[model samples]
Target: MRATVDFAPLFRSSVGFDRMLNALDLASRIPTVDNWPPYDIVKTGEDDYRIDMAVAGLAENDLTITQERNTLVVTGRKAQEPQSAAEYLHRGIAGREFERRFDLAEHMKVTDAHFENGLLSITLKREIPEAMKPRRIAITSSTTRAEEAVPQIEARKEAA
Candidate 1:
């Protein structure tokens, strides 16, 4: 007996099938997705997230964080030093330069970011309005409940 894999069901609906194709294309572009400046993504709470990238030896002025067209760009470049009186026998530190980009979701904006202790921390918060938040509708029965159980004629006479 031979095992048969079913993939037709995946293409039956157009919900996220296109996204899967786009992801496949993107995967083919990048040879490796290794985290250069190792980072951590922490989910602080609902609709709140924090991204911490280890960018040591990088000063506040050397790093830049910007949002462009739903993309979070983090770029860092070390300040150049004069080599007139500096000489190194063996240098193995990786403080050269690097740029990292993170794709942001819709309505997901960066609230704040900070650089401290050689770690660049970027905070993101999703602004979901009251209507956008998930709400539980109150189930009602067919019976009508009176507001105060008052007589209609009495209420009309009082208003007059």
Candidate 2:
């Protein structure tokens, strides 16, 4: 039994959160999909992340990673088997093609990807642009500036 979530209240009260809400909706609808090629997402650092996928029989050339806006897509297609291949009595490792998508947060980007020991590792870094980072603004009191200027002006007038 799948529980449905209604985001009507969130949609009505929030602005500029459409992407987050859409991601939530997408996650809620993921129960029907195949869970082949299991993966793990880990936070390596404060702003760095890694996704390790268990692609047992896939080679480096069999995988393709793409980034479109805030979405990261990882696809794998196994090479065609030769006609003279030996038949296996019991086949367990999955060589089937799969496409996995990850919805990244703002500023998240794929830095690198490599395969080793039957595992595909994808590195991600959240690189917030300098313009988008939080900055401190110096606050000055107008009243203090006015008072200092008035005293200076009065002193100049008395001298004159």
Candidate 3:
């Protein structure tokens, strides 16, 4: 059973959450997508994440990772076999072409990707710009301002 959520009310008040809400709605609708290659998303640190995908029978050259805006795309395609006829009795490892996409949050970028022991690990980090980071503004009292004003008043009276 699939549950439907109406986002019309949310869209009325939210300003920049349309993409996130749309992604959730789209994901809920698509319930029959294949999960051939298993993957894991882990939060390694406060602002760091890692995605490990099981890509057996695939080498580094057979995989391609791309990032466009806030989307991360990982694709795998096995090389064509040489001109030789070889029949397998029991084939288990899947080398089929597959493409997986992950929607990343704003300012999140892919740092590195490496394949080891049939596991493709992709590292990501969220790098917020300096201007966007939280800052503390020092508040001054009104009395301190009046005390500093008295000195400037004396200087002006002497000049007059």
lDDT of each: 0.79, 0.90, 0.92
**5 in model 1: Cα distance from truth in Å?**
12
Q: What's the C-alpha lDDT at position 78 in model 3?
A: 96
- Using all chains and alpha carbons, the TM-scores for the candidates as numbered come to 0.69, 0.85, 0.87
Question: Which residue segments of model 1 deviate by more than 4 Å?
Answer: 1-11, 136-160
Better of 1 and 2 by lDDT: 2
Over 4 Å off, model 2:
147-160
lDDT of 1 by residue, 1-160 (tens): 4344444566575576665556555655566655678889899999899999988877899998999967899998999965777788887667768888887776788999998898999999988677888999986654645444655554344553
- Residue pairs whose backbone atoms clash in candidate 3: none
Q: In candidate 2, list every pair of residues with a backbone clash.
A: none
lDDT per residue for candidate 3 within 1-160, as digits (tens), equals 8888888898899999988889888887888678968999999999999999999999899999999999999999999878768888998999889999988999999999989999999999999999999999998999888777454333344653
RMSD of 1: 6.2
- Pairs clashing in candidate 1? none
